[model samples]
Target: MALRVAAELRRGQVVNLGIGLPTLVANYTPPDAGVIFHSENGILGYGPHAAEGEEDLDLINARGEHVTLPPGGAVVSHTDAFAMVRSGRLDVAVLGALQVSEKGDLANWMTPEKGIGSPGGALDMAAGAKRLIVITEHTNGGAPKVLKECSYPLTAAGRVDLIVTDLAVMEVTGDGLLLKEVAPGWSVESVRGLTGAPLRVSDGLKEMDFTLPQHPPVNKVYPSAAEAVADVPDGAVMLMDGFGGLGGMPHYLMLALRDQGAKGLTVVSNTVGIARVSGFGTPPSPDLQAVDHSILVERGQIRKAIATFPVSPSPSRPSAFERAYRRGEVELEVVSQGTLAERLRAGGSGVAAFYTPTGVGTVVAEGKEVREFNGRQHLLEEAIRGDFAFVRAHKADTLGNLVYRGTSRNFNLVMAAAAAVTIAEVDEIVEPGVLDPEAIVTPGIHVRRVVQRPAVFSPFQPIKPIEDNGRG
Candidate 1:
């Protein structure tokens, strides 16, 4: 049915599809068909639905799923969007129907069973478009919908040009409803048995084709980390993943973010900043401008930090974030290490919040809901999602599939899936099928952009175990 609807759309046509069933048409429209989809929400030529777990809260369709704009797509204001509708720019408007009459009357706004109805842009599209096509079921709960007169409230009278249903396809003419084609296994006599209006069977009537079509694959590679995070705005919640200092840190991306200068950021990380010890972790790169999230804090770009460890293990060597906090320069939300990882995982999985016993009885239980499971009290921890994720990986395919080495996999894998845009900096960029499928830590669907880290900097190496001397 979706293929049949897509066949009606011509190349270079601007189309508006109503909510619900009409939205499915966009999914099935062939990528090369050149049909531009315009949404009442103000985006024209938006790309397909976002890959799961990579939903950007800001860019969305009417259904509230995150989306993107094509290379030539335009994002207009709400007023300008309505202008496109009312100014006769739309060539076709395909909508779902509650009931359509023989005389081309459309009743799709509401039914008698429901009191409230949304007239959102449907009224405008119906009244303004050159052609209107209705897609719906033949019957509403086993009742006829192609009626002599519609029983539901009318959206537009004498406007519907075509109707496609589960039973048959009909064209509205000045005389009556003309049956152009019938669904498979459905005959003219059986269709007439279900219609309230008289049917005029076409001399060349045929069967509707239900062949499925394939959706196009998208390429998600960006040239540089700066360009990858170029669109990130101020006041964005960012997830930065690293453990044991620079081993798994997104060093170059953080440097790019600091240079990008988007202020008032709320960074969510396992640790607020990277801490270097005399003989542990990876040594800092001298040529690099900054090494960790502390660079952003030192530059005063971050407004708040939600972290598991905000201070260094060594009391004498305070990190930049601890200094900022001590001076009342930035806000902090302290979360337990386990709870923080779970929160990020939950956030990406669409869970709002969960209860945990890690922070219970401490200050973390202050204003949160405390639930008793059995006898122990648990504190509710809200999920931690972000606008952008800065991830470090050993390698990435052009499609953004990431593979990590050793400890680099910590937090990096989960953080990649927990943000709207996961910008990855990797040591190498390989083509598809070059990396082992089983070695893929995070699939390409969850990543938005991938940039190759320069070879000048070395990969993080782990500290070797110290041997004991028997001098004591």
Candidate 2:
């Protein structure tokens, strides 16, 4: 729960940590995250828990737990710490809650059985912080902690923005508590069964993943794309993101994958690619090289492709995959674009099959199950998962969170989530927390490795303009 909330932290944000589980967020934050830890006890810029004998008497958090002070950290006066919270300098405040209401009311300070609890700065932080994240168990002693209304005294009304628990992660939205993601071993039905209030499920609801390192992840930065994808084996299911151009394709990674000679691969993508005439969605810039699926197809490394645009729009201009298919060297499974996107999303969300009304009574539905949905036939599309995914991003942090440029953010986002191991090729990689959390399209949890594109390399030659040697 703490790690999930920690992912919400952005660079240069001052976060106030309430007592208990909320305090553990400090331990999960990346060492170089650049987040300033604020405690009501007057410590600022504190580090993780202190090692046994290295504990400093003066360096303790609001909970009185021994902690470490990073360089440039300072001990402030009690007045100043509370002043920071009251003045709304804290970007986020994570508080422990006894109970939260559907209306976003908090009830952590006092309960009838618990009696009057220590009020302690929580009320002020809850009201003053830019955003509030509440961490707690989904239930307390067989009773739901998330209630239709808080029976206990309120800490702050309509202040909580998010709720993180062992069972589920929810957002306090206008409709109600919106179920975002559920923990592993939990089902929506089971979570709803335990909640005191009605829950509104999000369309993008997925499993709350914990694949990231438990304690501040080890630096996953690799030196180059070659080393990053060196271990990719034969007969792998590879996911490549692009729209027949350079906008979002993992050019360097695909080059490395080709050089690595990992053959007999099945590829999932939006297009099989027209390499010779492809650019960043422009009219094939001569200065830009298109190192997309065509490279892998030309190398004969791809055994098959699952794509929407498997062939070029013009029959005269055949893609490499199309030519290969003509020669019986490659296979194709055509799907509608929307179904393809949903199929990848289902793979990441652990759904085996979903019904869609696309391709009915057509060749696309030839071998699939057909069902009736509201008097319309829907085909059952099985989810597509990948052994490896090669994705491109404009920038990446050491932790592997990514920010894409322009239409480059297309299939890359869903492909990253659907793959077993995702390798990202980026132009720049910064230290953790260097990026705005909102700008990150692909979280580091889904990315296994980060490799920087070579600083100096020309993949395409500039085409010379044709001179008018004859009359038009």
Candidate 3:
């Protein structure tokens, strides 16, 4: 199967090898091949397997387990990693799968069999990449892994473009699956017979010309505080910013950290919402309890959360109920929105404390110093810091200047400027000196990495005219 699979590798491709099956590709990438491997945890260079005591403690791939960085390899935060993927900086993303439908839909995130099927980075990779290459076993339990159609749950709707199995290589097309190449000893029909699902054939099905994936370093365009804290040792305090999915790339990077199983993360954000898009213009009221990645952290899966605010979900959803049931483990400390913003700002400004009336008489005042000024009481909140900050903006110029769009500007701009390392994810990457200087929101000084994501999903929230209220 390795021999059959190695042929699909092409030199100079930025590749994402999936966790289980796809990770194997890292071991197989040819030494002479120049393909760069991107781990979601923010590493961009990889070398062959290491000899004893040769591996650097800092070099690691997206999965967060220790890995070796090839010569000229660099490390950034997960926010920077996804920036590369979303910006179309990568040539190919090799993902693993539970099933591949005739229509090329991938259902690898969760099987009915697995308890917690966090889609994690798969959703981002599937939707953001220009080309997605999935590598998986032909079948699970003698049932074909390829299917007439996916009966399991879908991770991203209709995203996969190519599939390489032990027996053959097939491409997804608008009409159906197209058989592109077959192993030397395997017949198309033989490959089809072993597949538990229906198969499609292309008019030009043939053997793939074997080659290694390519890797070429595009110059770094964005510079941020990441360079400032590059010397921070691994396993130090790391804080990220995002109100979960809608906010920006921070949550994406947080998931990458969770996957890496990196401990001692002192996450300080407004709120950790559900895995997918939970809140964004649902009327800023705080009744929503999003099922954040903290769900994993609370179960002793990761470390404890040291920030304020509990998961607030929207009305009438089962996930909200599940979150409530698990509230005991969450150990949340709720804070007012204004206070959260100020606290983060203070952290970035290197301020020890800030006075705010937002949480004065409420439960939020349980701990800390309280003082009366002009007959009004105020509680003091301390500053916070982390090894990194994952942020996404709408656009970036070649010099790493950034501009955010609409509600996308929320928490993102502040977090972008606040973190030790700010990674910007933009939908478009233009040449230097192109954007109007006035339109630039976050200056190039705050942004460390700028990657353009052409097809990053920004759903249209149709604006409706407000009907007249009785008060009006």
Candidate 4:
């Protein structure tokens, strides 16, 4: 059944395989198929399941089983992973279903009147994927799982595109359930007998093909953050990976760059930094600890910045980068968030430039060539590249294969690919074989160095409270 479903996958499609039998599709995928597997736990480009002792406890799929990662695979934050689903970036989503209606409604997350269930990412994937394919048994205990109307709560209304059961292959069309094929030896009447919904056989019904295709994991680790940034010279363009402040910003690496005193640097990032504030409570002292690129700007390391948000909104509490720009000490080039991501992706993928309508009719279109496409104007935006990128991850093997945790993976994944030299600051370092091959988000080929963060740098540490400076 898994092989049959896998055979339906086309090359260069981004697919998300649900738990159970759907997960087996990864194993049957041909090495040259170019199907990128996405796991809701925040990994893309994952390979097949691991065998025996090859499992890495820290590396697992959404099903919590060990898996392998492909060469150009990436890991992202949970939010970003779902963003890819909700934004219709996923080509196909193969899921298991409890019940499916003739109108293509899906009901797999939960049962009717039973509040006990985990929806996980089913609703998002079902509604957002370009194609939703359900793979399940034809019957459960002699009861048909397909139905005229789903008895269970709907995962998404009228979203299923295809349904592959153990007994038949069906497509959900506007007309109704169109039976395209059946399992070998099973008569059309036999499949119709098992289906609860009205089944119309295709005129050219054929046997479902299940021919299996034969299928077919670096280092870079650095010692300290200081040593990792030691080679970054002055006036070099650097890609700083982070979203907000807590999302995998290379905090220690930024501190090291401040100490390294590399002057006149160009930095590209989502934000420059937040403002400093005094510590709260008993001590009532100024909180001088720097967590983002603000420290670099404070030390006059950044001569220019290309980013979406360069300063905090409040004028009275300007960020360090803002202060420097106001004083004619730094250059700023603002860009739309979407364009920034595309630019970096293009840079890493070796695409020169692309046009988009995002910044049309705005100041962002200044000096850039505009092209008309389908009666709309789009500005040509060049790709962004960097000499070095400072990234953070949860775990890395000796070969610089990295796995990120939770929301920390945001921009780190993309920046790793866009930089000439990618330096990763991770919490833990393991042996090369200790990591599950499928769990690695950043392949070592993209990473030039890996630095392990000190054990004391806890991700969950409370933000320093600002001291009241009498104004409050």
The candidate maximizing TM-score is: 1
Clashing pairs in 1: none
User: Local distance difference test, per candidate?
Assistant: 0.78, 0.80, 0.61, 0.79
lDDT of 2 at 285: 61
Span of ten consecutive residues with least summed lDDT in model 4: 277-286
TM-score of each: 0.58, 0.55, 0.46, 0.52
After superposition, candidate 2 runs with Cα above 4 Å error: 1-217, 277-289, 457-472
Error of 2 at 280 (Å): 7.7
lDDT of 3: 0.61
For residue 113, model 2's alpha carbon misses the true position, in angstroms, by 19
Candidate 4 ranges with C-alpha deviation above 4 Å: 1-219, 275-287, 458-472
**Candidate 2 residue-wise lDDT, 1-472, digit = tens:** 9888888787656799888889888877886776778888876667888999998887788899998865535555576566556544577999999999988899999888877678888998898788999999999998999999999999999999999998999999987999999998899999999999999999999999554343343556899888999889989999986765556788788877767777799999888876554434333464654566777787778899998988877788787789999999998998899999989877764567899998898899987999998999999999888988888888988767788898887898778767878898888988755776435666564677999988874444243232332311
- Candidate 3 or 2, higher TM-score: 2
Choose the strongest candidate by lDDT: 2
Better of 1 and 2 by TM-score: 1
Please give, for residues 10-105, the per-residue lDDT of candidate 3 as tens digits. 654567777777777767767566566777876655666566687656665656556765443445567756655654455677788888887778
Q: What is the lDDT of residue 233 in candidate 4?
A: 89
Q: What is the Å distance of residue 92 in model 4 from its true position?
A: 32
